[model samples]
Target: MLSHVEVTARVALTSVAHFVWSNRLEYAHDCFVCRRVGRTVSLHPNAENGLCHSSERRLEWQDDIDVAGAHPAPIRVTGFDTAGDETSQRLRCRLAFWWSPFFDLKRPDERASELSEKRWVRLHYRVGCHVCRDAGHDDWFGPQNSVQSNQVWPVTSSCQRCDTELVTVAGPPEINLVG
Candidate 1:
């Protein structure tokens, strides 16, 4: 059997509850949960999304946001045709970030009065329950995307609902190059 190819689903702009910055002038993006800096990237680069957005496995609605300083920015989310197909219509402002109330530590590079285990780093993870998905068919019946935090988690996990083993796939495609 042949599987349909759709790489666009993996292309996305990720926004964590908080950003990870480098100790030096360089900026970075990492798996905040593990404090693993895969590589350092620029804050802004002269680039464009060359991918054809004319049509793809994406929402028809797009959000246009304008922010200046701490001001409440005026935002707009609309579709070319609101009354169009439901599958093609979605909002970009999905509430997918969670902040830990116990977030209480400065960046690791920052000097502290004294070294102590009380230090903490906010965590984040992209989780899914393949078993709960019921052989990759159910959507609403499974844990889709989880935004959570804790000191640490096991490298491998189990389906909260079905107890199926879950493991993080090896790198490369799992890391969003466009992100």
Candidate 2:
């Protein structure tokens, strides 16, 4: 059984991931902080946070908009341009299936084996990038190219437009457990 905190974290993380993936806000969007800064927002999926280049703002999973808003802020993985680490995290088995030999079942052996393999492992990763939304540059990062699950955030990145070094820290997200 998972502790209350762990369970809440998992639920929040899943909900945020679902929201981000569904909205496709992992790319060029207005930064949650300085709404004036319009550029590529880096989303660290595994870390459950991201950083915006416009202001070098770090976004967390728990960051929320007001109740009157129709949607929550966008979630993204930072530095999706570069490769990140992948790790396995185990998930609890919630269902129990009893295989009865006498029952007429199609591929009973396969069904039993499938149910028996309830212990699951999920891959987590992390990445980082500078939020350079220069109108001329096309270096945009998104979920498919950038998101990492269960890994540390990148330490350094350069603004694609200004070439200035940006220090990035994988800030602890409200939701710690991904799987």
Candidate 3:
């Protein structure tokens, strides 16, 4: 039999794997920003190739992002917005869930009908700013930009209201459950 610690560790590991696998495809796109200048940038899928959206002078930006820190962070789905159609809304929900840091790989296919019926996709994670962690500050941790595809913005100017690091989990109607 598994001890409590063992069980917890197993669960945590499973959760991490699920999150990584589900969102791996999404991150495959070059989605990153310059931590120093707050300028939007992209990292090549192949890091060894040393390719980036900016000039070669900015190559150091890739090294500064700390991709490892982007993983194993707690996440939650917070909310949802729809322009009109249910199908479109569902697609958006799926996309959001795919990018979620707390993504659960087990739930979706099993409950496809239910989710489609409700016109909602479960947002399983929250996004935290790694730059804040590197700065030795915990006050601003939430998404600096609105939840858009492959976009990163400056957390300092955007998250000035909250002194504690702000983690924006999927909230309200978007995420069916509260964290």
Candidate 4:
């Protein structure tokens, strides 16, 4: 078994979501209901094809977006294409800071204050599952990538079924390298 490897990197919070999607890195998040690993369980009761697209396993994005102050930025989602295999394509969505809403605490005033504040946030790509206490399987986590990969994630979430608060892995400190 490969020992747990922790690599750190500095990334602007705004760009972290794009970075993860572009790199095709594997990330493991627990089921909001049973605490089962994202890759190992399906939350949808109607799901029959073994394809899970819910937030329990994926970070879905809205239809329209504003990037760099550009209104209605045409965001595109490009999935992993297996050469000559159209049916095998893997769809991964890029998440942005706006995906997680943050209120402007500084300005309680209604008219003058900005509605939300967007800032770079620190996140951790858990190398393994804390509940299972196993690190033997690489697929249990997100895709493995080079050290330059940028990684960021939603700060808080809840299991849709059980409503249990989901917790992500803690981030690396004082390290400018990303894994």
Q: Which one is best on TM-score?
A: 1
RMSD in angstroms between candidate 3 and the native structure over all alpha carbons: 19.4
Give each model a TM-score.
Answer: 0.23, 0.20, 0.18, 0.18
Which of candidates 2 and 4 reaches a greater lDDT?
A: 2
The CA-based lDDT of model 1 is what? Answer: 0.22
**How would you encode candidate 1's per-residue C-alpha lDDT over 86-134 as one tens digit per residue?**
1221111101111111222334553221111221111122334534554
Output the TM-score of candidate 1: 0.23
Preferred candidate (TM-score higher): 2 or 3: 2
Which number leads on lDDT? 2
lDDT tens string, model 4, 9-89? 332222112123122332222212221222221112122212212232122221122222211211111222212121111
lDDT of each: 0.22, 0.27, 0.23, 0.23
**Candidate 3 per-residue C-alpha lDDT over 41-82 given as tens digits, one digit per residue, 9 for 90 to 100:** 222222322211222222223334444324221112222222
Pairs that collide, model 4: 8-177, 8-178, 9-176, 9-177, 9-178, 25-143, 26-142, 26-143, 27-142, 32-159
TM-score quality measure for candidate 2: 0.20
Candidate 3's displacement at residue 98, Å, is 25
Tens-digit lDDT string for candidate 2 (7-113) = 11111121111111221222233323333222233333343543434433323331232223223233433222211222211222111111222211332342222
lDDT pick, better of 1 and 3: 3
- Lowest summed lDDT window (length 10), candidate 4: 112-121
Residue 56 lDDT in model 1? Answer: 15
Please give the lDDT score for candidate 2: 0.27
